[model samples]
Target chain A: MKAFPAIAIASGKGGTGKTTVAIHLAALLAAQGRAVQYLDCDVEEPNGHLFLKPKMERSESVGIPVPVVDAAQCTSCGKCAEVCEFNAIAMLKKPLVFPELCHGCGACALVCPVGAIRETSRAIGVVETGRTGTIGFAQGRLNVGEPMAPPLIRAVKARRNPDAIALFDSPPGTSCPVVATVRDADLVVLVTEPTPFGLHDLALAVDTFRPMGKPMGVVVNRADDDRRVQDYCQAENLPVLAELPDDRRVAETYARGELVFDRLPEWRDRFDALWSRIEECL
Target chain B: MKVVITSSNKTLADPIDMHFGRAKFFILADTETGKAVVHDNAQNLHAAQGAGIQSAETVAKLGAEVVITGSVGPKAYKALQAAGIKIALLEAVCPGTEALRRFKDKELPVLDKPNSEGHWV
Candidate 1:
């Protein structure tokens, strides 16, 4: 059996249509009788399932512990605060923790000489698995006001099937979330608009991916039937795999939570070509 | 008088770290009056796997007298103090860059004591 190809769709900035492209790509692959696993790693604001609408089959919670100091064991020595790297512990006279700043590494307990710190799990998000026809879907839903997302993203990726084409829908920005989603990708397809802001963020995304040593290509979402995006791609040596012009049909289809490939048969050919290029590179 | 933040490699600017190690980076800023340098190493270097002990040593080598950063788990803190590196625990900020910049500007509110947790969110 051939190895399943894993492709991640990411954008440096939000609102550039990463999920929109991911949905169509999954549909395109499933149309070709290939089993695909669609993972929504944007735990902060997962929206891929909004379009795919897979049926939930399994769900699990992802949690990280926020250490609680046993004041009885605490000698007011300020040792816990002394060893913490995140500044989560505040030990001027009494040691306290700021939950939002905690990464739950449990280093404080290990470092504490008195062993005053004990860990309790804090629920950060939920990973849900569902199925839509032949496509398997998974998504991480982050709790409101949680600062961390990478841990939950990694949790979703860990559940990915080795034999299914993993189509990852990454969160926006070139920060930790995007890095978590794209780090192990076989190929990264950056979907961006044709404006200055789009190009600016696209450059940042390219820089983020450059370190991973992965093959990347750009898919111009709403190419505007213009040359601005094309010129930038040409100058940057980035291959423009597909030009999705600004079309009301695509927009209308997307707004109704419908897959673009289902509405437009011709676009499936373009998606297939992009997939083939990525496969060849791998 | 140079400020050096050393990760395992020289790539601290990436913002998104893959290492999740005990050390993220050791930020070393030169002191004008004192002969010592100021620095802080990331708490759990392996969790983020970002920076390591080498980064802290680099900061110490730069002659930093004081170091301002988030947490420094006990083992690393002892080593830094043994090297005569004064430690200051910085107030946690969501964007670590802003917290680091405040330290450079001498505007960061720092705690004279160490923190009680491992991860810096």
Candidate 2:
């Protein structure tokens, strides 16, 4: 068995082709006879499933334990409220727990003097696993109105297969959810375009991931659209792994839930080269 | 009956604050004695989340039977309602004392549902 390297595809700004690059790379790798696992860590709105078209095998609910107060045992001491940093718990003659605002740190339960506070798991999302040919596919779907995504993202990442290459499709921006997706990845591919917004957010993502001491490379989608991305990469001494052309066909195919490698056979070589460059960085 | 009104300033002549959760002060006044006490709500003004819930808890702890404000979010409305606090909407910006007078004279309308969306503050 070969040691599988986990690579995370992330972007600073949304719609920068993170999913487009991830699914293509995963498909190309699996086509090369290597076992691969594709995990969509964008729990807020997972879309990789649309392209992968994996069979719906099974799903497991994910949740965090929120404190529930027993009114009969509660003395209205206000200690639970005082210990809550998120202000999720409040005592107004009785303890009231706002589950929406809770981070599920369980501090309130620990501080309850009367042992009135107990934790109850509230479902926030679900992790679904299936297969697209030989490629393992998993994604997290956060329930509507649920504010938290890190817990579900963690659940998705926990399904990582050490026996195969793991490719993670992280959510946009440099928030906590993105961190949860790319934290321990072997290599992080920062996808960007040749635009001011892309460069600005790319810099923010670099600032966030660089401090973690992880090796990173940039992929400039719609490469011929602008030269600024290449110029920025050169100035920053970052490796340019792949440059995808700005083709309307690629966009149209993606919109129709199709893979670039499948629609355009010529691009399979390009994704194969992208994987090699990522290997060099690792 | 004790009434609480969100205010921008501590004085009775100050304008009623349009925001409920982020208001500077909550004036707790007695309808019969006309005695008003100002409770500073500066701590919750800078809260990143759940300011409305904390603000609702503050007034409920102060033993206010009624609340008068320009707008109320769902979380605060739920908390106030659970605390058995009657909510009255001012509809327009007016002096804090005027809002109290309207409440006493039955000119203000009771709010059964939240007027503004959550996180409005």
Residues A1-282, candidate 2: write the lDDT tens digits: 127889999999999999999999888888888999999999888999999999979899999999999999998899999889988876776877889889899899898888998999989999999999999999999998788899999999998877889999999999999999999899999999988999999999999999888789999998775788888889988899999888899899989999887779888888888888998888
lDDT of 1 at A150: 92
* Model 1 bad stretches (over 4 Å): B1-121
Q: A222 in model 2: Cα distance from truth in Å?
A: 1.0
- What is the lDDT for B10 in model 1? 30
How far off is residue B42 in model 1, in Å?
19
What tier of docking accuracy does candidate 1 attain?
A: incorrect
> Which stretches of model 2 miss by more than 4 angstroms?
none
Recovery fraction of native interface contacts for candidate 1: 0.00
Model 1 lDDT, residue A155, Cα: 91
Q: What is the lDDT of residue B107 in candidate 1?
A: 79
Clashes of 2: 0
